[model samples]
Target: MTSGKIGNQASLQSIFDPIIAAPSDRPFVVAQLGQSLDGRIATASGDSRGINGAAALDHLHRLRSNVDAIVVGIGTIIADDPQLTVRRVDGPQPIRVIIDPKGRLPATARCLATGDSKCLVVTSKAEAVPKGAEGLVIKASAPRIEPGDIVEALFKRGLKKILVEGGGTTISHFINAGMIDRIHILVAPLILGSGIPGLSLIPVGSIDEAIWPKTSAHVLDGGDVLFDCDLRHQRRG
Candidate 1:
């Protein structure tokens, strides 16, 4: 491998060491988001493509390869339609888990198609999995499923390392629920003056009340900055 590739691998290892060393009885959940310098994940019309550079994209695929499963909210499915595979690197593909509370996943969604990796749909008890999707269905309480419950269910199924690859809503749910152990926020150089914001959480009254996670910053090959925030102890009680 080239020196640059070696450097990237070393950086990834350092970033993932804590997650890989997490306790086995529960899931080690990490959430990731790629946004612009101004914190917009997409434009006003929901058009989010190429927000991060090639190096940051590789970093994401490396994350997918390490985790046992990857989870996303249905909004992501409808918008990005990502296959959620480990194509950029050589590692076992993680299971694709979708939080589809309303059963809105279309029949033709790429994630639902037959593939090397298995797909699991987590829905509300009131909803059913879309027809003809060859995967397991997990049901939780109505309106929405608790992030903790989702983590527990996945852990029971042997998915101990989980990555929440999302639209902002899904990551926020996990963070607000105190189920996330860490979060990786990759910030690109561009600025979107107006668009969909990257993350949304309960507001704090003052700057002192804001969460200041123990974070480490790394510059990716193409100038995107990756902030590895350690939230293991900063989670809400």
Candidate 2:
């Protein structure tokens, strides 16, 4: 069996040693994703069909089992219409959160009416608040529905840990905002040479470059890989 160390073999320190903050009032945020060998999370046209194997999907559900909440963007909700619940195992489903900046989430989405899970739609103060949804819709005032703002709102609601399963923009927004505490990236063995790149809008510049996304990775079953990185403060690149 191939065995690896978290720090020595994979630079887990470089990835997770920094501290954005210890467990605080705000929920800790983690960005979780799986990409192809070529680092693509979807197709060239933004399709994520069959990108992950059944084992990878099941592994993701396992990861989901440990969090207090799960977040995604409205675009992801519309495109995937995911139930965003814990299944395939006997574990409590985390709360479901959607960042709908323009208040665009449909009232008819399953998230709105699910009794098994609570749904929180993060929207801007200026945008019309979504109404008639069975789920608890908590509104927070912000100039814009930014990545940091979303976490603050969740924290206020007493969720201490959040998992982000994204559509790229949402993940990148948190990465850029320096709000992500850890990143759990799963890598599949296949390669999608030309697809929607897994990362979106990382800042470019000496100052922006100072924040680096360093990670230590391990290979999981079925040729899948896992990288856990701490983003709060790693040595500025």
Estimate candidate 2's alpha-carbon lDDT, on a 0 to 1 scale: 0.70
Model 1 ranges with Cα > 4 A deviation: 1-7, 125-127, 131-141, 235-237
After TM-score superposition, the amount by which residue 225's alpha carbon in candidate 2 deviates from its true location, in angstroms, is 1.0
Question: Weakest 10 consecutive residues, lDDT, candidate 2?
Answer: 1-10
The candidate scoring highest on TM-score is 1
lDDT of 1 by residue, 56-88 (tens): 888899999889999999999999898888888
Give the Å shift of residue 89 in candidate 1: 0.9
